[model samples]
Target chain A: MSVEAVTAENQAPPKPRRKLRNYLLDPQFQMKYVGMVVGVTFVVASVLGAFVYDFSTSLTDSMMANELLLDEYQGSASFQQIEERARAFDRFVLISIILGVLSLVVALGLTGIVVTHKVVGPAYKMRLLLSEIGEGRLSLRGRLRRGDELQSLFVSVEEMVDRLRAEREEQIDALDRAIAKLRAGDDRDQALASLEAMRDQMARSLE
Target chain B: MSVEAVTAENQAPPKPRRKLRNYLLDPQFQMKYVGMVVGVTFVVASVLGAFVYDFSTSLTDSMMANELLLDEYQGSASFQQIEERARAFDRFVLISIILGVLSLVVALGLTGIVVTHKVVGPAYKMRLLLSEIGEGRLSLRGRLRRGDELQSLFVSVEEMVDRLRAEREEQIDALDRAIAKLRAGDDRDQALASLEAMRDQMARSLE
Candidate 1:
């Protein structure tokens, strides 16, 4: 095979890899992250709840004491003033209790939601993706839940896979054609040249 | 195409839809299943906790009532007996409270572990698998968690795919040979016969 023929075959355009569908990163551990959150929530809520419980007890006692004083000293103050002050104290405890309870509930719910979405939700999604890959759907692309590191990682891997598959396919195709021409009894020189060129191309593409 | 060639090609293996890798059922959704369990666990634990709180209140009241009776009926009962009964009641309450508290703690822990394994663990694993898939590892078999329908499903799909890919490669090779022979003009009749056989095989395999 002429050197020119060899060079021409070697220079055949590389085929783009099939966009690889990545199934990397099990995403199963998101459950652990979620578990951590649940654990933390319980701890935090317990601590905060204990504080609220203590504060409520103290406030109730203090208000009751103030009530006793107000009743005993009512004659010294205007009725309106005494009543207004008592009302204000009552309102404070009531509001504090309400706020504390509401905050605790809100925090708990948010923690649950955050944990579920961040961990549980992704797990379910990963299962879906793995199944897709298992089904021989190599063309699948992983879409991360949001613009996060995880998502970036998946996307980047998928992109790399695609490049690799494309390159591989190109070499395989070139090898196939070279083999076919050689099999068809093209002049021995030309076929040999093509074979050498295809091999070089395959190696380079692999690299 | 000769009858012999047609028969040879037609004898090729069958094909399948959606290659399965293992015996897992919906292997892709295993993580989802785990997440669901975790979600259910959290919900159940919260509910149980609420019940525990209510039970604690009722139990405390009952203990208090018993205490009051002990005090009020002191004259009827011997001092020692009264003390003994009070102690008994105290022990009962203490035990019940301990059990209730223990249950809560245990339930919380289990929920964490379950959520961690199912939701978090799978996500990371899936990410890795996907990454590998993305890296052009077409032969990657999604690892199946043990003793689940998902694993079975994965296996089933993988098997199907393997069979089909093998069949396709075989057909491609035969087709190439037939075409090559036809082009060489040495055995056009035989090549044509082989082509017909391969076509038949392809049809049967797809079915």
Candidate 2:
């Protein structure tokens, strides 16, 4: 391989740009939250929107009634102006309600995903590492993102693996000494074989 | 102890009512989400409230201007009615904005805590278990609540611990066989001592 290629291979791979699916590492967990917040906001907005509608409608009706009472005293141009203004107010309220609810859902949904990703992303990575450990591989080789939740948990797992690796080394050392001592003794082939088997098991686990 | 008390001791303690502190198991993590959702909602509400205010004010101003034009044609009683209606609409809009934003914050905040709690609670419990495992206690106990996030991750850790315990047992079994064989061989005392030491180390890790 070229020197630059080898150097690149030795270095950690470049971090991937986070995809939409990545932000939703645990969608059920995140969506349950987003749904509740958006749901509540929608209800609240609807109630207030209704109140604004009712109040404005009353104001418009009373204004129209006044315009009707003055029909004999006022021009048709004035009546048209009042009716047009009421319609404009109603249209504004309708637009506000639709736009308000739409933006709230979008904002809350994005926040929910980003927030839950911090917790779920690290957990997803740790679980993969953990399953490897379950399969007898103690040489763990990954880390959580800097801002991920559960950093302390990840550290504990790393420490546990380190301790396991250290304990295995000690067991192997002791096995080596025992095997050496057995080699010097008479008719010790069987004991030496067992010791070697135990060492090999420990050695395999370390990888 | 009475029979009832003894039974109670053997049984798992009653699950505590989830406290506010428990819901906020990781305040910094949970709040970042709640704050973002609430902040966005607040900003959106403010912009829409401003739009509503501007729309209403222009409508009221035009009506008031019409009332002034009609002043020469009508009595002060009609003018009073239009002005009062305009002020009421203004008051209603202001109340809607305040109440809407207040309730939105309250609703989103509660939802944030409850939702993040599902993920954080399990993680918090698992971290404690992991640290215990780090200290060489492979016999894990306790489980995540049914609705909690990361159930699969918890299962993986449990499996890893079980594997480690099983490996330790096999290592101990091998050591036992080696020590027995060494006991039968010449000049085997030193070898037996090393084998016994290795077995003891493996046995200690199982706890």
Candidate 3:
């Protein structure tokens, strides 16, 4: 591979694995987004509702004027027909407003869930990994699927564990060497002094 | 109190404590319930949508028949007017159906959230508590707000912790006694034998 290509490949992050079942992962994180969507829908519903109301009102007024003019000529059938039309229109407007709001809310809720899943899935995994590490399971590593949020968090945690493991290994190696020296016929006083010094260094390293 | 009343009171389960922020405590547990509601709403919407279509179709057919008769008699004004009314009513029905579906979806989505909160809240708390315990903070307790779901889970975990603490305390006491016996001027062999016995018992208890 070309040097630039190799550098680019090395810089690229690991790909995330696919999840088995996509359930709602992070309800808490998605709640605010859902709220915002619902709020916008509510506003839209209100505006549309007002428009429907105004349109129906104008239709009603026009129908009433037609009915009033027809009354002078004794056209009862036309008047009744106009009245029925106006009532039907009014009912239509009401239904439109209700359905519009409902559909909006459901759509928003589902969208929020999918979006939040990206965040919550990773969070749940991190929590489990952290718990294992906290229990002194230094072998445990953080891993997240592709498209998961908090990539930086995974990197930071892994780096922290790497440092801790390195320090612990070094301290253990020094202690082991000190004991081996004492056992291999070093002067008792000098060996004891060296072991004590090693102990202090171990303590300082831990700190 | 009357005997029957007293008996009834004694048999009744304890009331859940009241909480200040009395909303969305358990989302995880409520997931199935929310799904059911959404499913039912979808069915209802479908049925209502069909009804609206059928009703509007019938209305349109009647208006068409009337218009055909009026057209034959050269009553163009009446025919045009009837056609307009039918069109208006058709639009009204369409709007009503749309609004009905939208409103239902929104309402059901919001309801599902409230129900799910009751479950998700408690589940989240348990995760945190488990993490703490895994980190060796066994003294920490699992607590949920009033009226939260998974009350049994909290109780079970607390009992488990209680048993573990008791066992640990007993083991510590035994070790302390054994150490004290070894340090004090007891017969060396007898002290060692007793200490060994205590160690075996401690091991058995832990097992």
Winner by TM-score: 2
**All candidates: TM-score:** 0.38, 0.78, 0.43
lDDT of 1: 0.46
Best candidate (score: DockQ)? 2
Lowest-scoring 10 consecutive residues by lDDT in candidate 3 chain B?
Answer: B198-207
* Tens-digit per-residue lDDT, B9-61, candidate 3: 88867577554234445433344445655565566555646664565556466
Record all residue pairs in model 2 with backbone atoms less than 3 Å apart, i.e. clashing.
none
Interface RMSD of each: 11.2, 6.8, 11.2
Scoring only the A-chain of each prediction against the true A-chain gives TM-scores of 0.48, 0.73, 0.69
Fnat value of model 3: 0.00
Q: List, residue by residue over A54-117, the lDDT tens digit for candidate 2.
A: 7667766666665655665755547677678667767777777778777877777776678777
lDDT values for all models: 0.46, 0.73, 0.55
TM-score of chain B of each: 0.42, 0.76, 0.69
TM-score leaderboard ranking = 2, 3, 1
The prediction achieving the highest lDDT against the true structure is: 2
